[model samples]
Target: MIKGINKMLTKSKLEFLVGLGIIILPLQGLAAAAPTEMTKDDWLGKLKAVAPSVICQGFFEDASLKKRMEELKIDNDKCISLIPASFDKCQTQYYSGLPATMNKDSAAKWGHTIGECIGTDFATKYLVSNPQASTSSSSDQTTSSSTPSSTSPSTPSTSPSTPSTSPSTPSTSPSSPISSSTPATSSDSQSTDISRDQWLAQLKTLAPAMICQGFFGDPSLKKKLEDRSIDNTKCVNLIPASFEKCQNELYSNLPTTLNSDSANTWGHKIGECIGTDFAKKYLLPTATPATSTSSQ
Candidate 1:
């Protein structure tokens, strides 16, 4: 009886030890799987290093887009300096915090982890809205969206045929002086409209306003024009907020150099730029600055 009792106790002890080991092993594995978070300073430093690649990736050739990226970069640096970094609840936070507009391609480009995207978005917002946290929090904000749609509908037709009597024909008549002059006037108007459209299209693609004021001194615009002429164009109303900022800068800084007409022309050029193929590339949401492994 004594031997049986001792054997039972040993077996139970071995089972308990095995169970405890199983539980602890998984916990240790989890700890290893979890990633460490970075401090704001280290994260921002990494971002600063990677920023040129991020900003220049899509539309660097366009001066207006480059200027906007530069403006954002300034705010990015300031925000990273001021804001503390934290990403503990990455999975839970990312699911809840992701923007409605964020897509898979964007995530692949910007996300270290899904949660990092949320952290980035928050950082950008804080940086963009609050300047130094000491100055008033009245931030300059702008929003834009586009929806292009075209549809064609066909109408059903019904007709009835009836017998008719022969009718007398009218005598031949010469062209009237009014009709003769009308063709010339119409031709002149059409020519003027075509010329205006071509000019506006070229101006829009080139963004002459940003280019003209030392923003982008690409001689390529003139070269492109000489190589291939623009004939057809679509008008656009939306322009980047940076254009307004640039205009204000020009007016305030160089009052004698840039007039209202010049500003207006630049404004139109910006509008035209927004209508091009590159607009979609440039308009994509900017990804957040990357986080550092050692930041935590």
Candidate 2:
């Protein structure tokens, strides 16, 4: 009777193990065969659902990319939540490999690459129209200056353009009212809205091209400009008379570098050089009125 009971227990355990395997094996196969590609809606849906760690292998570790994502209103928690979907979508569309098979470091790199693609897409789709939304914190000083304060009502009535509490009012006196200043100049437009740091950053980003074109005299860039029917001299000139005009022409025609998609990749260094040249030749001269007057 004891032998019979022991045999019966062993048989039951074997049956249970076989049943468990039957249930799990198909689910494993289904997971392995899961689709990779996603539609536009699918991309967004994944971005909205995935965890941030999956988004960028611990997203906060990369400060610059993390800040960029946050600027897109993808906060840390939201970013984490969106990572799984975004990673899957990215793997389907942009990256074509088995992310599951990748090791820890490789997976992190893969995640970051996918994150950047998603970030670029986010910028193109949402940021173009709502530029202010992303940079609100950095631009707070400018926003505050533009905002109507408690004294603004009384101040605007007295001086429509100038803020009532401006320190420059002491120098203006009764003779030269700030509002009666020279006609709005293109130079003013160039300087306004953007801060010194902002302009300098922009200049640095564009300096490489400016140095190549204006200083080094890049022949290929010149030929490209000529081919476009653009006045090559305008782009290459740093002299005051033609400098601004040339820069304007180059800036407007920048998109033609190699079509809009490839332009940024090929044109970034050139653009940086142009920005540097503009700062040295144009921005510097106009920015220092006192020094120029003293020299004269």
Candidate 3:
């Protein structure tokens, strides 16, 4: 009986090996395929579902990455499995491939959460260091001083050199009080409410070209801006139609690998929120009129 059982087991094992060999023979010559290209809508979905903040945060300097590798005990072999790899691949694919499926509004809110973890100073530093970045907007200071008065009966001259110093600059001792009857400028239709000064101040900048009211999605962000008296009207007046236009330009300009929507979504994902929310949550209130430092 023992001899018969041994014979049966050996035969079964041999049959299984033969079956496996047959299955493997046809596929041996083919190379593995690359990951499928992610579309913008796909990225918007992921970003909405899973925020990329954890991966995108921190100093991306090569030395910093090496240090992080040591601290995290990351095996060199496993680095490809890490989200940081996605961050690195941004040049090849534009955005972290992980962010394509996010909801735009939620992406904005979660960005604030990440900003809370890192201070605002870090946020600006990260943004400023980006190779493809643009100028920081001193929107309020600029428009407050530079914008023409919607209150003025006079039309704004369009020449850039002539600087469209709007209805009033602060130093001017205008004879008339800013009147309610002052005609609405064409820009006024953009927002439903708020004074022109406050409105223009809301216009914030994004890297590579972006005009976004993305923060309006967050109640806390809204309250913070409100505390600072930032409203949509001022934002509209200062930015005008630049918001959507900037979004497209910035989106299109993302690294060649990423699709446009993915780039657009990611710009809102990593750039706008980090830059703006960091100021809103961590930096602004603590900012002193003198040295801008933090408190314990």
Most TM-score-accurate candidate: 2
lDDT, candidate 1, 52-72, per-residue tens: 122122112223323433544
TM per candidate comes to 0.17, 0.23, 0.19
Worst 10-residue lDDT window, candidate 2: 150-159
| Stretches > 4 Å off in candidate 1 | 1-92, 95-116, 132-296
lDDT for 244 (candidate 1):
40
Residue-level lDDT tens digits of model 2 in 167-281: 2332123222222222211122112132223222233322222232332233443353345333524433332323234345455444321321222232333333334443343
- TM-score of structure candidate 3: 0.19
Ranked by TM-score, the better of candidates 2 and 3 is: 2
- Reference-based lDDT, each prediction: 0.23, 0.29, 0.25
Q: Which 10 consecutive positions of candidate 1 have the poorest summed lDDT?
A: 154-163
Clashes of each: 3, 24, 24
The segments of candidate 2 whose C-alpha lies over 4 angstroms from its true place after superposition are 1-89, 129-296
Q: Which stretches of candidate 3 lie over 4 Å from their true place?
A: 1-214, 236-253, 256-274, 277-283, 287-296
How much is the lDDT of residue 50 in candidate 3? 18
What are the candidates' C-alpha RMSDs? 34.7, 31.6, 29.7
RMSD from true fold, candidate 2: 31.6
